[model samples]
Target: MADRNPGMDLDLEWVSGVRVNTQAVLKRAQQVQGRKVAKKEWQAAWLLKAATCIDLTTLSGDDTPSNVHRLCMKAMQPIRYDLLQSMGMHDKDITTAAVCVYPSRVADAVKSLKAANSCIPVASVATGFPAGQTPLKTRLEEVRMAVEDGATEIDIVINRTLALTGQWAGLYEEIRQFREACGDAHMKTILAVGELGTFTNVYKASLVSMMAGSDFIKTSTGKESVNATYPVAIVMVRAIRDYYRKTDHKVGFKPAGGIRTAQEALVWLVLMKVELGDQWLTPHLFRLGASSLLGDIERQIYHYVTGRYPAYHELPMA
Candidate 1:
Protein backbone atom coordinates (compact mmCIF):
# COMPACT_ATOMS: atom_id res chain seq x y z
CA MET A 1 0.00 0.00 0.00
CA ALA A 2 1.12 3.55 -0.76
CA ASP A 3 0.51 6.65 1.34
CA ARG A 4 -1.37 9.65 -0.04
CA ASN A 5 0.02 12.93 1.09
CA PRO A 6 -2.76 15.50 1.44
CA GLY A 7 -0.22 18.24 0.88
CA MET A 8 0.24 17.26 -2.74
CA ASP A 9 -1.18 19.99 -4.95
CA LEU A 10 -1.75 19.38 -8.68
CA ASP A 11 -3.55 21.89 -10.83
CA LEU A 12 -5.34 19.50 -13.13
CA GLU A 13 -7.20 22.38 -14.79
CA TRP A 14 -4.58 22.68 -17.52
CA VAL A 15 -4.81 19.01 -18.44
CA SER A 16 -8.58 19.12 -18.17
CA GLY A 17 -9.00 21.79 -20.81
CA VAL A 18 -6.58 20.19 -23.24
CA ARG A 19 -8.83 17.79 -25.05
CA VAL A 20 -7.18 15.63 -27.70
CA ASN A 21 -9.57 13.81 -29.96
CA THR A 22 -7.40 10.71 -29.81
CA GLN A 23 -9.13 9.26 -32.86
CA ALA A 24 -8.32 12.34 -34.89
CA VAL A 25 -4.73 12.36 -33.68
CA LEU A 26 -4.45 8.71 -34.62
CA LYS A 27 -5.98 9.40 -38.01
CA ARG A 28 -3.56 12.24 -38.65
CA ALA A 29 -0.65 10.09 -37.56
CA GLN A 30 -1.74 7.29 -39.88
CA GLN A 31 -2.13 9.68 -42.83
CA VAL A 32 1.46 10.87 -42.44
CA GLN A 33 2.93 7.43 -41.85
CA GLY A 34 4.45 6.65 -45.26
CA ARG A 35 4.25 10.06 -46.85
CA LYS A 36 7.20 12.38 -47.34
CA VAL A 37 7.67 14.66 -44.35
CA ALA A 38 6.59 18.23 -45.11
CA LYS A 39 9.36 20.75 -45.89
CA LYS A 40 8.81 22.72 -42.68
CA GLU A 41 9.28 19.57 -40.58
CA TRP A 42 12.27 18.27 -42.54
CA GLN A 43 14.85 19.63 -40.09
CA ALA A 44 13.14 17.85 -37.23
CA ALA A 45 12.95 14.77 -39.42
CA TRP A 46 16.66 14.95 -40.16
CA LEU A 47 17.56 15.31 -36.49
CA LEU A 48 15.60 12.14 -35.86
CA LYS A 49 17.43 10.68 -38.84
CA ALA A 50 20.75 11.45 -37.10
CA ALA A 51 19.35 10.18 -33.79
CA THR A 52 18.38 6.94 -35.48
CA CYS A 53 22.09 6.41 -35.93
CA ILE A 54 22.48 6.12 -32.13
CA ASP A 55 22.77 2.68 -30.50
CA LEU A 56 21.96 2.51 -26.77
CA THR A 57 22.59 -1.05 -25.60
CA THR A 58 24.17 -3.10 -22.86
CA LEU A 59 27.54 -4.59 -23.89
CA SER A 60 27.55 -7.36 -21.33
CA GLY A 61 24.60 -9.72 -21.43
CA ASP A 62 24.15 -13.43 -20.82
CA ASP A 63 25.88 -14.20 -24.12
CA THR A 64 29.32 -15.79 -24.32
CA PRO A 65 32.35 -13.49 -24.08
CA SER A 66 33.29 -14.07 -27.72
CA ASN A 67 29.78 -13.17 -28.82
CA VAL A 68 29.75 -10.10 -26.59
CA HIS A 69 33.16 -9.07 -27.96
CA ARG A 70 31.88 -9.46 -31.50
CA LEU A 71 28.82 -7.31 -30.70
CA CYS A 72 30.92 -4.65 -28.97
CA MET A 73 33.44 -4.53 -31.84
CA LYS A 74 30.62 -4.34 -34.35
CA ALA A 75 29.03 -1.48 -32.40
CA MET A 76 32.34 0.41 -32.60
CA GLN A 77 32.96 -0.17 -36.33
CA PRO A 78 32.20 2.78 -38.55
CA ILE A 79 29.87 2.02 -41.43
CA ARG A 80 31.91 4.10 -43.86
CA TYR A 81 34.88 5.21 -41.84
CA ASP A 82 36.46 6.83 -44.90
CA LEU A 83 33.33 8.67 -46.02
CA LEU A 84 32.78 9.94 -42.47
CA GLN A 85 36.31 11.39 -42.73
CA SER A 86 35.32 13.20 -45.91
CA MET A 87 32.21 14.50 -44.16
CA GLY A 88 34.44 15.70 -41.27
CA MET A 89 33.13 13.11 -38.78
CA HIS A 90 36.39 11.12 -38.68
CA ASP A 91 36.49 7.74 -36.92
CA LYS A 92 34.32 9.05 -34.11
CA ASP A 93 31.16 9.73 -36.13
CA ILE A 94 30.24 6.07 -36.37
CA THR A 95 30.37 5.65 -32.60
CA THR A 96 27.08 5.81 -30.69
CA ALA A 97 26.02 8.95 -28.82
CA ALA A 98 26.38 6.85 -25.66
CA VAL A 99 26.69 3.27 -24.57
CA CYS A 100 23.98 2.43 -21.96
CA VAL A 101 24.86 -0.41 -19.62
CA TYR A 102 24.16 -1.84 -16.21
CA PRO A 103 25.80 0.14 -13.38
CA SER A 104 28.42 -2.55 -12.72
CA ARG A 105 29.82 -2.30 -16.26
CA VAL A 106 30.13 1.51 -16.44
CA ALA A 107 33.85 1.48 -15.59
CA ASP A 108 34.77 -0.93 -18.37
CA ALA A 109 32.66 0.88 -20.97
CA VAL A 110 34.18 4.23 -20.00
CA LYS A 111 37.76 2.92 -20.10
CA SER A 112 37.38 1.00 -23.38
CA LEU A 113 35.91 3.94 -25.28
CA LYS A 114 38.02 6.71 -23.73
CA ALA A 115 40.18 7.07 -26.82
CA ALA A 116 37.16 8.00 -28.92
CA ASN A 117 37.06 11.78 -29.46
CA SER A 118 33.41 12.14 -28.67
CA CYS A 119 32.62 12.72 -25.00
CA ILE A 120 30.08 9.91 -25.25
CA PRO A 121 28.49 9.87 -21.81
CA VAL A 122 28.14 6.55 -20.07
CA ALA A 123 24.47 5.98 -19.00
CA SER A 124 23.68 3.53 -16.21
CA VAL A 125 20.43 1.80 -15.27
CA ALA A 126 19.87 2.40 -11.57
CA THR A 127 17.23 2.28 -8.77
CA GLY A 128 16.39 -1.38 -9.36
CA PHE A 129 15.99 -0.79 -13.06
CA PRO A 130 12.92 -2.12 -14.91
CA ALA A 131 11.12 -2.83 -11.62
CA GLY A 132 11.93 -0.06 -9.14
CA GLN A 133 10.25 -2.01 -6.33
CA THR A 134 13.09 -1.81 -3.84
CA PRO A 135 13.31 0.23 -0.64
CA LEU A 136 14.14 3.92 -1.07
CA LYS A 137 17.53 3.60 0.65
CA THR A 138 18.60 0.75 -1.59
CA ARG A 139 17.49 2.64 -4.67
CA LEU A 140 19.40 5.73 -3.61
CA GLU A 141 22.55 3.71 -2.98
CA GLU A 142 22.26 2.18 -6.43
CA VAL A 143 22.08 5.67 -7.93
CA ARG A 144 25.14 6.68 -5.88
CA MET A 145 27.17 3.75 -7.18
CA ALA A 146 26.26 4.62 -10.80
CA VAL A 147 27.39 8.22 -10.32
CA GLU A 148 30.64 7.13 -8.65
CA ASP A 149 31.20 4.61 -11.45
CA GLY A 150 31.27 7.55 -13.91
CA ALA A 151 27.72 7.57 -15.23
CA THR A 152 26.95 10.94 -16.77
CA GLU A 153 23.27 10.05 -16.90
CA ILE A 154 21.28 7.91 -14.50
CA ASP A 155 18.14 6.17 -15.81
CA ILE A 156 15.69 5.33 -13.03
CA VAL A 157 12.48 3.40 -13.38
CA ILE A 158 9.47 5.14 -11.83
CA ASN A 159 7.48 3.36 -9.16
CA ARG A 160 4.72 1.88 -11.27
CA THR A 161 3.15 0.24 -8.24
CA LEU A 162 2.67 3.59 -6.58
CA ALA A 163 1.56 5.37 -9.74
CA LEU A 164 -1.01 2.69 -10.55
CA THR A 165 -2.39 2.70 -7.04
CA GLY A 166 -3.07 6.45 -7.44
CA GLN A 167 -0.39 7.21 -4.93
CA TRP A 168 0.80 10.18 -6.99
CA ALA A 169 2.37 11.82 -3.97
CA GLY A 170 4.38 8.75 -3.14
CA LEU A 171 5.60 8.45 -6.72
CA TYR A 172 6.44 12.15 -6.81
CA GLU A 173 8.49 11.93 -3.63
CA GLU A 174 10.35 8.91 -4.92
CA ILE A 175 11.41 10.81 -8.05
CA ARG A 176 12.32 13.86 -6.02
CA GLN A 177 14.64 11.77 -3.86
CA PHE A 178 16.09 9.96 -6.88
CA ARG A 179 16.80 13.29 -8.56
CA GLU A 180 18.74 14.42 -5.49
CA ALA A 181 20.64 11.15 -5.42
CA CYS A 182 21.70 11.66 -9.04
CA GLY A 183 23.41 14.92 -8.09
CA ASP A 184 24.63 16.57 -11.32
CA ALA A 185 23.89 13.60 -13.56
CA HIS A 186 20.81 14.02 -15.75
CA MET A 187 17.91 11.92 -14.50
CA LYS A 188 15.75 9.98 -16.96
CA THR A 189 12.55 8.60 -15.38
CA ILE A 190 11.17 5.52 -17.05
CA LEU A 191 7.32 5.54 -17.06
CA ALA A 192 7.16 1.99 -18.44
CA VAL A 193 4.38 3.21 -20.73
CA GLY A 194 3.07 -0.26 -21.52
CA GLU A 195 2.43 -1.18 -17.92
CA LEU A 196 0.76 2.13 -17.21
CA GLY A 197 -2.11 0.70 -19.36
CA THR A 198 -3.58 3.72 -21.17
CA PHE A 199 -2.73 6.94 -22.95
CA THR A 200 -4.45 8.90 -20.20
CA ASN A 201 -2.32 7.18 -17.58
CA VAL A 202 0.76 7.77 -19.68
CA TYR A 203 -0.13 11.44 -20.01
CA LYS A 204 -0.73 11.80 -16.29
CA ALA A 205 2.51 10.01 -15.47
CA SER A 206 4.41 12.26 -17.85
CA LEU A 207 2.97 15.31 -16.15
CA VAL A 208 3.77 13.99 -12.69
CA SER A 209 7.33 13.14 -13.68
CA MET A 210 7.99 16.58 -15.20
CA MET A 211 6.51 18.23 -12.15
CA ALA A 212 8.72 16.10 -9.96
CA GLY A 213 11.87 17.44 -11.69
CA SER A 214 12.73 14.79 -14.21
CA ASP A 215 15.29 15.90 -16.78
CA PHE A 216 13.70 13.48 -19.24
CA ILE A 217 10.69 11.14 -19.22
CA LYS A 218 11.34 7.82 -20.93
CA THR A 219 9.08 5.10 -22.34
CA SER A 220 10.29 1.64 -21.34
CA THR A 221 13.26 -0.39 -20.02
CA GLY A 222 13.13 -2.94 -22.87
CA LYS A 223 12.09 -5.51 -20.27
CA GLU A 224 8.31 -5.41 -20.74
CA SER A 225 5.90 -6.93 -23.23
CA VAL A 226 4.64 -3.48 -24.27
CA ASN A 227 7.74 -1.50 -25.14
CA ALA A 228 7.94 1.91 -26.74
CA THR A 229 5.22 2.66 -29.26
CA TYR A 230 4.31 5.68 -31.37
CA PRO A 231 0.95 6.33 -29.72
CA VAL A 232 2.29 6.26 -26.17
CA ALA A 233 5.22 8.46 -27.19
CA ILE A 234 2.80 10.90 -28.75
CA VAL A 235 0.92 11.16 -25.49
CA MET A 236 4.06 11.77 -23.45
CA VAL A 237 5.47 14.35 -25.88
CA ARG A 238 2.20 16.26 -26.06
CA ALA A 239 2.03 16.40 -22.29
CA ILE A 240 5.61 17.67 -22.11
CA ARG A 241 4.93 20.23 -24.84
CA ASP A 242 1.84 21.48 -23.08
CA TYR A 243 3.65 21.65 -19.76
CA TYR A 244 6.47 23.58 -21.39
CA ARG A 245 4.03 26.03 -22.88
CA LYS A 246 2.50 26.67 -19.49
CA THR A 247 5.56 26.70 -17.20
CA ASP A 248 8.34 27.67 -19.62
CA HIS A 249 10.26 24.59 -18.51
CA LYS A 250 11.87 22.26 -21.03
CA VAL A 251 11.91 18.51 -20.61
CA GLY A 252 13.17 15.74 -22.91
CA PHE A 253 11.56 12.54 -24.19
CA LYS A 254 13.19 9.13 -24.73
CA PRO A 255 11.45 6.19 -26.44
CA ALA A 256 13.40 3.13 -25.47
CA GLY A 257 12.89 -0.64 -25.77
CA GLY A 258 11.82 -2.69 -28.81
CA ILE A 259 12.87 0.08 -31.20
CA ARG A 260 15.23 -1.97 -33.37
CA THR A 261 14.73 -1.06 -37.00
CA ALA A 262 15.71 2.03 -39.00
CA GLN A 263 12.13 2.35 -40.13
CA GLU A 264 10.89 2.36 -36.53
CA ALA A 265 13.43 5.03 -35.67
CA LEU A 266 12.30 7.08 -38.66
CA VAL A 267 8.69 6.84 -37.51
CA TRP A 268 9.58 8.14 -34.04
CA LEU A 269 11.60 10.92 -35.62
CA VAL A 270 8.63 11.86 -37.72
CA LEU A 271 6.35 11.88 -34.67
CA MET A 272 8.68 14.19 -32.76
CA LYS A 273 8.99 16.48 -35.73
CA VAL A 274 5.24 16.68 -36.12
CA GLU A 275 4.28 16.91 -32.45
CA LEU A 276 7.07 18.78 -30.67
CA GLY A 277 8.62 20.49 -33.73
CA ASP A 278 12.39 20.85 -34.38
CA GLN A 279 13.47 21.84 -30.90
CA TRP A 280 13.26 18.32 -29.46
CA LEU A 281 15.16 16.47 -32.16
CA THR A 282 18.67 16.51 -30.74
CA PRO A 283 20.27 13.95 -28.40
CA HIS A 284 19.78 16.43 -25.56
CA LEU A 285 16.05 16.79 -26.16
CA PHE A 286 15.27 13.41 -27.68
CA ARG A 287 16.84 9.93 -27.65
CA LEU A 288 16.08 6.49 -28.99
CA GLY A 289 16.53 3.73 -26.40
CA ALA A 290 17.66 0.98 -28.72
CA SER A 291 20.21 -1.81 -28.66
CA SER A 292 20.36 -2.67 -32.37
CA LEU A 293 19.13 0.30 -34.43
CA LEU A 294 22.57 1.88 -34.78
CA GLY A 295 23.89 -0.60 -37.35
CA ASP A 296 20.86 -0.20 -39.59
CA ILE A 297 21.30 3.56 -39.63
CA GLU A 298 24.96 3.03 -40.54
CA ARG A 299 23.84 0.77 -43.35
CA GLN A 300 21.48 3.45 -44.62
CA ILE A 301 24.16 6.11 -44.33
CA TYR A 302 26.58 3.82 -46.15
CA HIS A 303 24.08 3.23 -48.90
CA TYR A 304 23.53 6.96 -49.18
CA VAL A 305 27.27 7.66 -49.34
CA THR A 306 28.71 4.70 -51.27
CA GLY A 307 25.80 3.88 -53.59
CA ARG A 308 26.01 0.25 -52.42
CA TYR A 309 25.56 -1.81 -49.28
CA PRO A 310 28.53 -3.48 -47.61
CA ALA A 311 28.97 -7.22 -48.17
CA TYR A 312 30.07 -8.06 -44.64
CA HIS A 313 27.64 -6.54 -42.19
CA GLU A 314 28.72 -6.88 -38.57
CA LEU A 315 25.99 -5.15 -36.60
CA PRO A 316 22.87 -6.96 -35.36
CA MET A 317 19.26 -5.86 -35.74
CA ALA A 318 17.59 -4.35 -32.67
Candidate 2:
Protein backbone atom coordinates (compact mmCIF):
# COMPACT_ATOMS: atom_id res chain seq x y z
CA MET A 1 0.00 0.00 0.00
CA ALA A 2 1.12 3.59 -0.62
CA ASP A 3 1.68 6.12 2.14
CA ARG A 4 -1.64 7.36 3.52
CA ASN A 5 -2.63 10.98 2.84
CA PRO A 6 -4.62 11.31 6.10
CA GLY A 7 -6.64 14.07 4.47
CA MET A 8 -9.49 15.77 6.27
CA ASP A 9 -13.08 15.97 5.11
CA LEU A 10 -14.27 18.69 2.74
CA ASP A 11 -13.55 22.02 4.38
CA LEU A 12 -15.78 24.31 2.33
CA GLU A 13 -14.91 27.39 4.35
CA TRP A 14 -11.19 27.07 3.67
CA VAL A 15 -11.58 26.05 0.05
CA SER A 16 -13.84 28.98 -0.75
CA GLY A 17 -11.50 31.40 0.98
CA VAL A 18 -8.44 30.52 -1.12
CA ARG A 19 -7.01 33.38 -3.13
CA VAL A 20 -3.80 34.60 -4.89
CA ASN A 21 -2.70 38.04 -5.96
CA THR A 22 -1.47 37.86 -9.56
CA GLN A 23 0.99 40.69 -9.06
CA ALA A 24 2.42 39.03 -5.97
CA VAL A 25 2.46 35.67 -7.71
CA LEU A 26 4.42 37.14 -10.61
CA LYS A 27 6.87 38.81 -8.25
CA ARG A 28 7.51 35.56 -6.38
CA ALA A 29 8.02 33.69 -9.64
CA GLN A 30 10.60 36.31 -10.58
CA GLN A 31 12.39 35.87 -7.27
CA VAL A 32 12.58 32.10 -7.67
CA GLN A 33 14.12 32.73 -11.10
CA GLY A 34 16.83 34.95 -9.61
CA ARG A 35 17.99 32.30 -7.13
CA LYS A 36 21.18 30.41 -8.10
CA VAL A 37 20.70 26.89 -9.40
CA ALA A 38 22.63 23.74 -8.44
CA LYS A 39 26.10 23.50 -10.04
CA LYS A 40 29.28 21.29 -10.17
CA GLU A 41 29.11 18.09 -8.04
CA TRP A 42 26.11 19.59 -6.27
CA GLN A 43 24.42 19.68 -9.69
CA ALA A 44 25.11 15.98 -10.17
CA ALA A 45 23.79 15.18 -6.70
CA TRP A 46 20.61 17.14 -7.34
CA LEU A 47 20.25 15.47 -10.75
CA LEU A 48 20.38 12.06 -9.11
CA LYS A 49 17.89 13.27 -6.54
CA ALA A 50 15.71 14.51 -9.42
CA ALA A 51 15.91 11.02 -10.96
CA THR A 52 14.23 9.53 -7.89
CA CYS A 53 11.41 12.06 -8.11
CA ILE A 54 10.63 11.29 -11.76
CA ASP A 55 7.45 9.45 -12.70
CA LEU A 56 9.03 8.25 -15.97
CA THR A 57 6.05 8.43 -18.32
CA THR A 58 5.13 7.27 -21.84
CA LEU A 59 1.57 8.38 -22.57
CA SER A 60 1.00 8.57 -26.30
CA GLY A 61 -1.37 7.42 -28.99
CA ASP A 62 1.44 5.14 -30.15
CA ASP A 63 2.42 3.72 -26.75
CA THR A 64 2.97 -0.02 -27.02
CA PRO A 65 3.60 -2.74 -24.47
CA SER A 66 7.13 -3.03 -25.83
CA ASN A 67 7.67 0.70 -25.24
CA VAL A 68 6.18 0.54 -21.76
CA HIS A 69 8.46 -2.38 -20.96
CA ARG A 70 11.37 -0.27 -22.07
CA LEU A 71 10.12 2.56 -19.86
CA CYS A 72 10.00 0.21 -16.86
CA MET A 73 13.55 -0.91 -17.57
CA LYS A 74 14.62 2.73 -17.63
CA ALA A 75 12.82 3.39 -14.36
CA MET A 76 14.59 0.48 -12.68
CA GLN A 77 18.00 1.74 -13.73
CA PRO A 78 17.56 5.36 -14.76
CA ILE A 79 21.25 6.23 -14.82
CA ARG A 80 23.73 4.44 -17.03
CA TYR A 81 25.75 1.73 -15.28
CA ASP A 82 29.09 3.33 -16.15
CA LEU A 83 28.03 6.67 -14.70
CA LEU A 84 26.65 5.06 -11.55
CA GLN A 85 29.90 3.13 -11.12
CA SER A 86 32.03 6.21 -11.68
CA MET A 87 29.99 8.19 -9.16
CA GLY A 88 30.23 5.25 -6.69
CA MET A 89 26.43 4.99 -6.72
CA HIS A 90 26.35 1.57 -8.41
CA ASP A 91 25.06 -0.11 -5.25
CA LYS A 92 22.66 2.68 -4.44
CA ASP A 93 19.79 1.30 -6.60
CA ILE A 94 19.18 4.70 -8.20
CA THR A 95 15.91 4.47 -10.13
CA THR A 96 13.03 6.70 -11.09
CA ALA A 97 10.31 7.08 -8.47
CA ALA A 98 7.60 5.39 -10.60
CA VAL A 99 6.61 4.23 -14.06
CA CYS A 100 3.32 5.74 -15.30
CA VAL A 101 1.21 4.57 -18.24
CA TYR A 102 -2.34 4.35 -19.51
CA PRO A 103 -4.89 1.89 -18.04
CA SER A 104 -4.58 -0.65 -20.86
CA ARG A 105 -0.81 -0.65 -20.36
CA VAL A 106 -0.83 -1.07 -16.57
CA ALA A 107 -0.38 -4.83 -16.75
CA ASP A 108 2.52 -4.42 -19.15
CA ALA A 109 4.34 -2.04 -16.78
CA VAL A 110 3.67 -4.30 -13.79
CA LYS A 111 4.90 -7.38 -15.65
CA SER A 112 8.05 -5.59 -16.72
CA LEU A 113 8.88 -4.28 -13.23
CA LYS A 114 8.16 -7.64 -11.65
CA ALA A 115 10.29 -9.39 -14.24
CA ALA A 116 13.12 -7.02 -13.31
CA ASN A 117 12.51 -8.15 -9.68
CA SER A 118 12.05 -4.52 -8.76
CA CYS A 119 9.38 -2.93 -6.57
CA ILE A 120 9.19 0.39 -8.37
CA PRO A 121 5.56 1.60 -8.30
CA VAL A 122 3.42 1.57 -11.46
CA ALA A 123 1.22 4.66 -11.77
CA SER A 124 -1.70 4.67 -14.23
CA VAL A 125 -3.34 7.79 -15.52
CA ALA A 126 -7.07 7.06 -15.56
CA THR A 127 -10.41 8.82 -15.03
CA GLY A 128 -10.35 9.74 -18.72
CA PHE A 129 -6.83 11.09 -18.59
CA PRO A 130 -5.95 14.59 -19.86
CA ALA A 131 -9.71 15.17 -19.76
CA GLY A 132 -12.39 13.80 -17.42
CA GLN A 133 -15.47 14.51 -19.55
CA THR A 134 -16.64 10.94 -19.22
CA PRO A 135 -19.77 10.27 -17.11
CA LEU A 136 -19.34 10.17 -13.33
CA LYS A 137 -20.07 6.45 -13.17
CA THR A 138 -17.62 5.80 -15.95
CA ARG A 139 -14.91 7.87 -14.28
CA LEU A 140 -15.29 6.09 -10.93
CA GLU A 141 -15.26 2.75 -12.71
CA GLU A 142 -12.08 3.79 -14.46
CA VAL A 143 -10.36 4.42 -11.14
CA ARG A 144 -11.49 1.08 -9.70
CA MET A 145 -10.53 -0.72 -12.88
CA ALA A 146 -7.03 0.74 -12.91
CA VAL A 147 -6.59 -0.19 -9.25
CA GLU A 148 -7.68 -3.72 -10.03
CA ASP A 149 -5.11 -3.87 -12.85
CA GLY A 150 -2.21 -3.25 -10.42
CA ALA A 151 -1.82 0.51 -10.56
CA THR A 152 -0.31 1.64 -7.24
CA GLU A 153 -1.02 5.27 -8.09
CA ILE A 154 -3.88 6.85 -10.08
CA ASP A 155 -3.49 10.32 -11.66
CA ILE A 156 -6.98 11.61 -12.46
CA VAL A 157 -7.74 14.88 -14.19
CA ILE A 158 -10.27 17.27 -12.67
CA ASN A 159 -13.39 18.12 -14.66
CA ARG A 160 -12.00 21.36 -16.08
CA THR A 161 -15.51 22.67 -16.75
CA LEU A 162 -16.33 22.66 -13.06
CA ALA A 163 -13.54 25.02 -12.09
CA LEU A 164 -14.07 27.19 -15.15
CA THR A 165 -17.69 27.73 -14.04
CA GLY A 166 -16.95 28.20 -10.33
CA GLN A 167 -18.45 24.85 -9.27
CA TRP A 168 -16.21 24.22 -6.27
CA ALA A 169 -18.70 22.10 -4.29
CA GLY A 170 -19.43 19.84 -7.20
CA LEU A 171 -15.72 19.48 -7.90
CA TYR A 172 -14.96 18.63 -4.27
CA GLU A 173 -17.67 15.97 -4.07
CA GLU A 174 -16.56 14.39 -7.33
CA ILE A 175 -12.97 14.04 -6.14
CA ARG A 176 -14.11 12.64 -2.77
CA GLN A 177 -15.69 9.64 -4.49
CA PHE A 178 -12.62 9.18 -6.67
CA ARG A 179 -10.49 9.10 -3.53
CA GLU A 180 -12.66 6.40 -1.97
CA ALA A 181 -12.41 4.29 -5.09
CA CYS A 182 -8.61 4.41 -4.91
CA GLY A 183 -8.63 2.35 -1.69
CA ASP A 184 -4.94 1.73 -0.83
CA ALA A 185 -3.57 3.29 -3.99
CA HIS A 186 -2.47 6.92 -3.96
CA MET A 187 -4.63 9.48 -5.81
CA LYS A 188 -3.06 12.41 -7.72
CA THR A 189 -5.53 15.13 -8.71
CA ILE A 190 -4.45 16.76 -12.00
CA LEU A 191 -6.00 20.25 -12.12
CA ALA A 192 -5.07 21.25 -15.72
CA VAL A 193 -4.49 24.79 -14.52
CA GLY A 194 -4.25 26.09 -18.08
CA GLU A 195 -7.98 25.66 -18.51
CA LEU A 196 -8.93 27.04 -15.08
CA GLY A 197 -9.14 30.69 -16.34
CA THR A 198 -7.31 32.61 -13.58
CA PHE A 199 -4.85 32.22 -10.71
CA THR A 200 -7.73 32.46 -8.25
CA ASN A 201 -9.36 29.50 -9.93
CA VAL A 202 -6.07 27.61 -9.75
CA TYR A 203 -5.76 28.45 -6.03
CA LYS A 204 -9.33 27.35 -5.25
CA ALA A 205 -9.05 24.12 -7.26
CA SER A 206 -5.80 23.20 -5.50
CA LEU A 207 -7.37 23.66 -2.04
CA VAL A 208 -10.58 21.83 -2.98
CA SER A 209 -8.65 18.89 -4.38
CA MET A 210 -6.67 18.61 -1.15
CA MET A 211 -9.84 18.98 0.92
CA ALA A 212 -11.50 16.20 -1.11
CA GLY A 213 -8.61 13.90 -0.19
CA SER A 214 -6.10 14.06 -3.03
CA ASP A 215 -2.87 12.39 -1.90
CA PHE A 216 -1.21 14.74 -4.38
CA ILE A 217 -2.32 17.84 -6.27
CA LYS A 218 -0.75 17.87 -9.75
CA THR A 219 -0.46 20.90 -12.01
CA SER A 220 -1.55 19.68 -15.46
CA THR A 221 -2.47 16.75 -17.71
CA GLY A 222 0.57 17.60 -19.87
CA LYS A 223 -1.79 17.83 -22.85
CA GLU A 224 -2.70 21.46 -22.32
CA SER A 225 -1.21 24.33 -24.36
CA VAL A 226 0.19 25.99 -21.22
CA ASN A 227 1.19 23.32 -18.73
CA ALA A 228 3.13 23.58 -15.49
CA THR A 229 4.47 27.10 -15.30
CA TYR A 230 6.64 28.18 -12.38
CA PRO A 231 4.15 30.78 -11.16
CA VAL A 232 1.26 28.29 -11.30
CA ALA A 233 3.21 25.62 -9.41
CA ILE A 234 4.05 28.17 -6.71
CA VAL A 235 0.33 28.84 -6.22
CA MET A 236 -0.49 25.12 -5.98
CA VAL A 237 2.32 24.33 -3.53
CA ARG A 238 1.18 27.20 -1.35
CA ALA A 239 -2.23 25.55 -1.25
CA ILE A 240 -0.55 22.27 -0.28
CA ARG A 241 1.29 24.10 2.51
CA ASP A 242 -1.92 25.71 3.75
CA TYR A 243 -3.76 22.37 3.70
CA TYR A 244 -0.90 20.75 5.62
CA ARG A 245 -1.08 23.44 8.28
CA LYS A 246 -4.82 22.99 8.73
CA THR A 247 -5.12 19.21 8.41
CA ASP A 248 -1.60 17.97 9.21
CA HIS A 249 -1.83 15.89 6.04
CA LYS A 250 1.25 16.30 3.87
CA VAL A 251 -0.12 16.02 0.34
CA GLY A 252 2.30 15.57 -2.55
CA PHE A 253 2.70 17.77 -5.66
CA LYS A 254 3.43 16.90 -9.33
CA PRO A 255 3.99 19.37 -12.18
CA ALA A 256 3.21 17.64 -15.44
CA GLY A 257 3.71 18.82 -19.05
CA GLY A 258 6.09 21.26 -20.70
CA ILE A 259 8.79 20.48 -18.09
CA ARG A 260 11.41 18.89 -20.32
CA THR A 261 14.98 19.81 -19.37
CA ALA A 262 17.53 19.21 -16.60
CA GLN A 263 17.54 22.92 -15.88
CA GLU A 264 13.76 22.96 -15.71
CA ALA A 265 13.73 19.96 -13.39
CA LEU A 266 16.34 21.56 -11.12
CA VAL A 267 14.34 24.78 -11.02
CA TRP A 268 11.26 22.86 -9.91
CA LEU A 269 13.27 20.96 -7.31
CA VAL A 270 14.60 24.33 -6.17
CA LEU A 271 11.04 25.68 -5.85
CA MET A 272 9.91 22.74 -3.74
CA LYS A 273 13.09 22.91 -1.67
CA VAL A 274 12.56 26.59 -0.92
CA GLU A 275 8.81 26.46 -0.37
CA LEU A 276 8.21 23.11 1.36
CA GLY A 277 11.63 21.89 2.53
CA ASP A 278 13.40 18.54 2.07
CA GLN A 279 10.37 16.47 3.06
CA TRP A 280 8.66 17.34 -0.25
CA LEU A 281 11.78 16.36 -2.22
CA THR A 282 11.21 12.62 -1.88
CA PRO A 283 9.53 10.24 -4.34
CA HIS A 284 6.75 9.53 -1.83
CA LEU A 285 5.84 13.21 -1.58
CA PHE A 286 6.82 14.67 -5.00
CA ARG A 287 6.88 13.29 -8.56
CA LEU A 288 7.75 14.90 -11.85
CA GLY A 289 5.29 13.78 -14.53
CA ALA A 290 7.79 13.53 -17.38
CA SER A 291 9.01 11.43 -20.33
CA SER A 292 11.79 13.26 -22.19
CA LEU A 293 13.07 14.70 -18.91
CA LEU A 294 14.94 11.56 -17.95
CA GLY A 295 16.91 11.59 -21.18
CA ASP A 296 18.06 15.16 -20.64
CA ILE A 297 18.85 14.42 -17.02
CA GLU A 298 20.89 11.45 -18.22
CA ARG A 299 22.62 13.60 -20.78
CA GLN A 300 23.63 16.13 -18.16
CA ILE A 301 24.87 13.43 -15.78
CA TYR A 302 26.88 11.91 -18.62
CA HIS A 303 28.45 15.27 -19.31
CA TYR A 304 29.45 15.59 -15.67
CA VAL A 305 31.10 12.13 -15.58
CA THR A 306 32.61 11.98 -19.10
CA GLY A 307 33.47 15.62 -19.89
CA ARG A 308 31.36 15.22 -23.06
CA TYR A 309 27.63 15.52 -23.66
CA PRO A 310 25.96 12.71 -25.57
CA ALA A 311 23.77 13.53 -28.51
CA TYR A 312 19.98 13.30 -27.98
CA HIS A 313 19.93 10.15 -30.07
CA GLU A 314 22.40 8.52 -27.67
CA LEU A 315 19.64 8.54 -25.08
CA PRO A 316 16.91 6.75 -27.00
CA MET A 317 13.44 6.21 -25.49
CA ALA A 318 13.42 2.54 -26.31
TM-score for each of the candidates: 0.83, 0.97
lDDT of each: 0.71, 0.89
Q: Please report how far candidate 1 places residue 311 from its true position, in Å.
A: 2.2
For model 1, residues 208-238, the per-residue Cα lDDT tens digits are 7877778888999899899987777778888
Clashing pairs in 1: none
lDDT against true structure, model 2:
0.89
Return the top candidate by TM-score. Answer: 2
Regions of candidate 1 where Cα sits further than 4 Å from its true position: 1-21, 37-55, 63-78, 86-95, 115-118, 313-318
lDDT of 2 by residue, 1-318 (tens): 336776666677776676689999899988897899978899999999999999999999999989998899889889888898999999998999999999989999999998889999999998888789999999999899889999989999999998898888899889999999999899999999989989989999998888888899899989989999999988999988988887788999999998889998999999999999998889889899999899889899999999999876776563
Worst lDDT 10-window in candidate 2: 1-10
